[model samples]
Structures are given as C-alpha cells and as structure tokens.
Target: MPLSVVDLYRDVLPRTNCKDCGFPTCLAFASMVVSEKLPLKNCPHIDPETAARCQKELDAQHAAGKWTRRDMAEDALQWAREKAASMALTDLPERIGGRLHGDGPDRELHLPYFSEFIRIGAGGIRKENGEPLNRWEQVFVYNHMAQGGRTNPTGNWKAFQEIPNTVSKVKSMRAHVEAPLAERFGGKAETLGRAAMRLGGRDLTNESRAADAVWRFTPLPRVPVMLLFWDRADEFDAKVTLLFDETVTDHLDIESILFLSERLTQLLCEDGTG
Candidate 1:
C-alpha cells in the first residue's frame, strides 16, 4: 500500500522542526522523501535500521501498489464540528470550564487559551482579537470533541510517560518536545521568560519553588502545562522538563498534546533565542 506523508513520517521522523535535515520541518522533509527529492540519510536523528526499514517500505510500495489511510485530520475536524454544533452551548462552562456568551441564536462557547479566548460558533471560530482562526478552531473543536468529565490541574506535575498509556511515546516525546526545547533556548535562558510571557505563562516558581525557572501555561482550559528550565552548568547540561496536568487527556487527545508541545517549542524559538 502507498504510504501517506504522515505514515512514513511517524516511522522515522522526529517530528521536530530542528532544520538539521535541511528542510525547515520534519513534515516538509517527509514530503521531500515521498517525492524522492531527499534521501533518509540526510536526517541524522533516524537510526540506520529505521532508515533502512523505511527505504525498504518505500521501494516495495513503489514497485507494487500504494495505499492511503483515511484522511484523519479532515474527518476528525468535521466530526468535532458536528458534535459541538449539536451540543447545548449552555453546558460548556460546567463540562469544560468555559463560559457561554450571548443568548439564543447568538450564543457561543468561550474558552480561555493563553491570553485569548477561542470563541466557538456554529459555523467555526475566531480569535479573541476577532481574527479568523482556521487552524486554531481545530484544536478548540478537538478539545470540545474529546472533553468528557472535568478535572483540576492537580498542581502536581508529571511527564508524558507518567500519564496512562503514554509510555510508548516517551522517546518520541522527548526527542520532539523536551530535547528540542532545551536545545533551542537553553543558552539564552533570559529571553525564554519573555517568550513564555508572550504565551500568557506566569512564573509559578514562588508557589512550588522546585525548578530554577518555572512557568505555567494554559494553552487551553483544563490543559495546564508547566515548563521547567534549568541552565547549563559545568557538570550538567541545560535541561527542560515539560509537565502536564494528569487530567489532560480528558480534554485533548495524545496527538493534540504533541501538537501543543511542538507549538510551544515553536513559540519559544520564534524570538531567535536559539
């Protein structure tokens, strides 16, 4: 069967936009691989065996037949939209910790995300500043779709593996989210604070006082993420620990968690701190 861009990517790609692979993003690199524009050896992170396996799969598929998986992104978004449109907006606050706005036909669900509120309407969504949120709407939609029971951020922080059923993702999550974050801003320790502030993160160190620098960010309601940064030392290299509320999966799927983590890394690196 023909492999999709994401399928081939999931096997060998780190899914981080580290740029060592020459393409700007691993996604783009995967595309280039699919198009025969770049070889797997260009990416250093992929082990020799994984690259060889991917190459064999590519060759076999190319010589025989190709298959495509169902378009998960579009289908999931449509399903989420339908689900949100059918539900009563009045129950949003209790279910997912978002307040309802307006009344009757004008009613919409308002959920806090960083410094902005993602407004969900029947048609789609908009940013707090009233800009069309084509990309962000999917997250809000998925948040609503996966949202079940409500839970608090427990103040206690844990790694992805510490969460249930997420142990398999520890290596990829560290490669894609944790290690890249440390590599990006671990040197410019001072500027990361401003970048975190841009994402509505506040220094929560005074409350817990465990990390050298601790910041709390709520990318979505009920999805509180804690980022702990430790500067490099003579004995220890720089480090970053990204923690999540245990109840995170209650509001977003594992894919969304990865997406949000990658997004945070992108935001941190955007200030050219790397």
Candidate 2:
C-alpha cells in the first residue's frame, strides 16, 4: 500500500510545523509530500538524518523522472530566498530611512571610486584618439547619490570630497554583507557578477586578469530601479573612466539619481559615524 499523509507526517515531519517550511502544519506538508507536491527539506527544524532519508527517497523518484513533493519544496524555498535577497534596501528604514526627502539644496555626496583597465578586442591596443594610456583607470563612481545631511557648512559635502578612499570602505561593506547572504542563497560572491552579466545580457570573460574589476550595484526600491558602475583603466593613457552600464537606464529613471545621491550620503555617514 502507498504511504498515507499521516504516515509520512509521523515519519518525516519534525512535527513542529514551525512554519519554517512556510506551511501551516506538518500534516499539510505531509499531504503535499505524499502527493509529490512538496519536499521534506523545506521543514527547517527536521533533523538532518531524517531529511537525508527523505531526500534519498525523493531522489529515487526524481531519478525515474517523476516529480516529488521534495522538488516543489526546494523550488519554493529557492524562490523565497531569491525574492528576499533581491529586496530593495529602500524598503528598510535602517537602510534608506523612513521618508523621502525632496531634492532641495546643499549636501555632500559620496560616490564609488576605483581603478582598472578595459581590454578591447583582446589585441591590447592601447591608443584611443591618438593618446598614450596605461592599463589602470581611475573613476569616481556612485551607485546612488542624492541630497543628504543638513545644509551646514560642516556637512557631508566637505567630508564627501575628502573620502575618495571609498574603495576600502566599499570593500569593507561588501565583505560584511555578501558572505552571509551568499551562504544563505547557496551561492558565492561570483554569483552576483554572473547575475549582473545575465541581467545586462553581456558576457564578462576576462575576470581572471590582473586588474581587479570593481563593480557596484545598488537597487533603490523606493524608485524601483537599479544602478551599476564599472570602473576600469585605459590601457594607453591609464586614465580611469567610470562606465555606467547602459542597462541601468533601462530599469531605473535617470531622475532618481538625485535620491540615489542622498541615499549614498546617508550610507557614508552611517559607515563613518559608527
């Protein structure tokens, strides 16, 4: 006889429900499990041993090209995590503040700055419009820069100018945010670049080169947009040109740059103030 939902729940579920599986009860999940509509792995509290057993069984069903409840659960969890990670920081008060401040006046804006080189056509041609250049490029780039802080003379504007050392700061921020999030998503830092490339419909082939390509992506949910900057050095003159990925304009309105600047200023203040 085939296993009933009750039997599956008794044997497979942690019996805690806990909503960790995103279902109301273990019985509900069990029903889905028996129907091959959900995966037992979705139950976060289930012991690893039991999960392994359930997975093994599910894998066998899958090997025969049959859909199992386990696959559905896995797919649901993946969708949830992806949605969470893609959530815009603008929705979080800690990240973007509660209210939108109008673009009124004076403030300091900090942007991302980095150095790198752009290799064209793989020939290593170093001349652009008849000028000698180096492989290193320097750029002052910002993901989001808008009006921030008071109009006081001692505001972020003054500090912003002094903080060209944004590279170390950005690196620190990326280190703090990327690792744990990547682990949760079953991915690594490289996954972000791959996703960006896919979204941009461009191929990034030369990532292993000596030049450390600094890419910054900031998503503003309030404005419903994404901002990206690619900094690299010219092979001939060695000048750095901050290139805005054209794809960004397609997704985000350029007018949002004002708010972006403000949000970035807030970020700088928080990072420095602490």
Candidate 3:
C-alpha cells in the first residue's frame, strides 16, 4: 500500500531496533526507507525476494522524487496546517484541551506552554504577543493539531518506559533526556526544584513518594510532564524519571513524547535552569 514502506519490512523485519540498517530503530529504518534514505539491501536480513521488491519500490519512489526528508517534513507541516484549519473552531478547546477565543475565522486555539499561552490557528501559530516561534517550538503546534484528546490528565502518571512503542527507545531516552536531567540536578535538590518551578512546574513533593523533588508541568495543554528525581546516594544511582499522563499516547505518538522530553532536558540545561 502507498501508506507503507515497501510492504516487505513490516512482516519481515526483525523489529529488534538493531542499528545494522544504519538507523537507530527498525521503525526509523522503515521511515527512512519510505523517505528513500536507505536502500533495502542495507538490512542484510531480508530474503532475496523481499530485497528485490524493496529495490523496485525504492526505485519507483526515487523516480517520483516524492520521498525525501525535506519532502516529508513539508508534507507533515502541510498536514498540520490543513488539519488545524479544517477543525471546528468551537470544538477545538474541548477536543484538544486548549482554550478557544473569538468566533468563526477569527477564532484562535490557545494552549498553555511553559509560561505562556501559544496561540494557534489556520494562519499558523504565534505567541500571545503575536511573535513567531522558531522551528523547534513549532512541534508543539503540530502536536496540538494531531492530538485527538477528549479527556483531562487523570493525575496518574507513569514513566515513558511504561508507554507502548517506547520500550525500544528507553536507552536513547535515557541518554538524551534522563541522563542529562540527572547530571544537572541529581544531587542539587534545591536547583532542581528551582529550575522546574521556573518552567511553571508545580512542586508536588508533599504528594509524591520516594522522590527528592517532583514537579508537574502542563507543557502543552493536555500533555503534562512530571519530573521525578531520586537523589544520588551511596546505595542508589542518581536518576531523573520523566513521567507522562497515562493517556499521553492518546494525544501524541511516542516519538513526539521523546521529542518533548529531550527538548525539555536541553532547554533546562542550556537555559542555566538545571
């Protein structure tokens, strides 16, 4: 099918996230294949029939020049635009956990982000002050369009590892997110709390368990991130556990979750908050 990547990898792939294919995960490989980033022969595990079919499909895709990173990113952006524009202005606030303003075409979808309300609409997003966002922050806008949430955070949170499809990405998540978080504020309990609070996160130390510091943040409306830190000790390794609302996948894919976590870590460290 056109929606698939050559159709051979789905059933034949080992799904092992082995980087033998030059991609971190098999899913990433599939996306790259669909984007024509790698040829099918790189996997080395596919049978001759599958390999040949993959080559044929790859050729077809390349001939059309339809599957490139730039092409796909543009497509995703266009999709976000269309989806946001097509959504019913009135129902958006309730459906996606954002606040709506105005009526008809003048309506704007506003979501709480860090310390501000990001205003989004068919014309694209801007800050409450009408300033534009960099490409990095635009992911939040795209996610807001794609999210299909209808409920609120249930207050129950779990680590990213608890989420489906994130099992294979745990190591990378740690390296990019948890590790940095721990490095910066693992033993500095006060700094951790201060940085989190700077991000508009609420300190929930009194309500949480076994945590040196715990802060809750609604980074993107329905999407909440819980920063839970266990201070380093002689008996225990220092750790930073980022937990998400149990229903996070209902609003975003696992990749988006990873993106948010990694970006949050980077922001905290780079902004000198961590």
Q: Per-residue alpha-carbon lDDT of model 2 for 38-110, expressed as tens digits? A: 6767777778887777777665665564543345433533443343344333432333223322233321111
Query: After superposing candidate 2, which stretches have Cα over 4 Å from the reference?
Result: 1-4, 62-274
TM-score of 3: 0.67
Cα displacement (angstroms), candidate 3, residue 68, comes to 8.2
Question: Considering lDDT, which of the candidate structures 1 and 3 is the better prediction for this target?
Answer: 3
TM-score of each: 0.68, 0.22, 0.67
lDDT of 3 at 208: 72
Q: Write the per-residue lDDT of candidate 1 for residues 63-90, one digit (tens) a residue.
A: 5535423456677667766655655667
RMSD of each: 10.5, 19.7, 9.2
Clashes of 3: 0
User: Residue 50 of model 1: what lDDT?
Assistant: 80
Q: What is the per-residue lDDT of model 3 for residues 1-274, given as tens digits with 9 covering 90 to 100? A: 3435545456757788779888888887877777755776788677888778757866776676765556544565566566556666577778776688877777888877786788877567788898876554566467666675687789788888888788889998999999988888767888776677677889889987648888888778788888888889997778988999998888877766887787788767765553
TM-score between candidate 2 and the true structure: 0.22
- Judge candidate 1 at residue 182 and give its lDDT: 82
lDDT of 3: 0.75
